[model samples]
Target: MNENVVVSADWLAERLDEVTVVDVRESWEYDGIGHVPGAVNVPFDSFRDEEGESESAERSGSDPRDAGTLPGAETWADLMGEAGVSADDTVVAYDDTHGVFAARFLVTAEAYGHTDLHLLDGDYSSWMREHETSGDAPDPDPTTYEVRDPEHSPFVGREEVEAAIDDPDSVLVDTRDDWEFEEGHLPGAVNLDWRELVDDETRGLKPRDELESILDAHDITPDKRVVLYCNTARRISHTYVVLSSLGYENVAFYEGSLTDWESVGGPIETES
Candidate 1:
């Protein structure tokens, strides 16, 4: 049980039987193409239930919040159990675009006391690339799962963010598309679109050289309190995982992102 990180495909492949690879990509992604052999398909969308007057009930372009915001510890336990996972089982999560959903699953699993969680370095595309000759399509498992969580879990809120922003010592980042950041973002926020960081053509994170160049271009110093955010929260969570996996020591995700700010009547600036 790796409490605080993601693992590589080669490492996971060697221990496939010991680890449970859970694919959090959409049903269409799994249904249209294929998935890891013997992997479980859990839709990221089903991770949440809807609320009032919120168009977010239906996925939106700028929706930063994912259905899979880490729920209570009990809820987390139940989700894993239903997915045919035990607390002691090593779990690996993956998604199509970025690792955010997978990270969420990993973190939620961690919060639920299942520390052995991992993220596939890239995603389904990366898996397909490595196993060019393999085609293992998995049917979603039919099981009753329950996620349990400790009542008092940690959460990052608006006030804390505001304080951080005011502190001048914390580095706040918006991990969304460039257009979304340009559309309207928190003051002093820097843009690092998750897409540019990954190899779109290959469907994995950019090579080490490319990734280093990107970070270097951004002048992202190693020692800093890095706080990542997005329209909602999933993307940032993934970014947090990515940065952490890269040996970043102090990184955190703003769980309730821009939408939460807007919900609080916060101001937004439009591009001219």
Candidate 2:
């Protein structure tokens, strides 16, 4: 968890100098309005196609390629290299919805051995809330990340998940929306909407009080051995960072989520 995630808005604000903050929102958001100062716009969808192009169609459910079994390491490395991310640099990524896309960005970075990655606790909404009085948005420096080794991402295999299922202390968290959770989910998994992590109006993650309430409601304590998975694991990884921000320990993400679950012959159940 320590290697893959970073938490605390104050912690990120303090290191604004050393870290490269990225806005991984949709290209439309970047093209229409603007983005954070000194931050680059790298959408999570950027890694879908082979040449690092984004599919901007905005489909529901997670992308299948995000599963560990889909794309090859070389493909992902090329995608990161096209983005200009450095292995040595500390990266901070965020998006409109909690940090799902941001987590995708981080996972890809980590796969390439960019260990110093951080997800902005609440992301764009949090930034706006802190700078509400500020008027003009700062210009973003046009930059791209360079990928090194794409094969190094943290993706749990289906076998790992099956092993954990009966392990008693292990917890699987589903990061999809509430409706998605109600429809069907991995048996024994808990549902905590990723939105709960941030403030509603500003869209930034909630302060400690709100974050605490969310954990309390989900029965997620700091010491629990937790693993998060969503339709394809992108958003759940983002949720992992949020949980890390709240000081939850022993949290990890399943690389291939529901898609892989069914593929591996894992059972599922509707919420009763």
The TM-score, computed over Cα atoms with residue i paired to residue i, of candidate 1 is 0.78
Tens digit per residue, CA lDDT, model 2, 1-272: 34436555566666777777777888778656556556666665665443212221122134323435334456665555555555567778877776667777776666555667777666666666654212233443333544454343335556666777777777777878888888888888889877667566655566778788777778677666777888765677667766765667577667667765765457887873
Question: What are the models' TM-scores?
Answer: 0.78, 0.74
lDDT of model 2 at residue 245? 59
Ten residues in sequence with the least summed lDDT for candidate 2: 51-60
CA shift of 35, model 1, Å: 2.2
RMSD of every prediction? 5.2, 5.8
Error of 2 at 40 (Å): 2.4
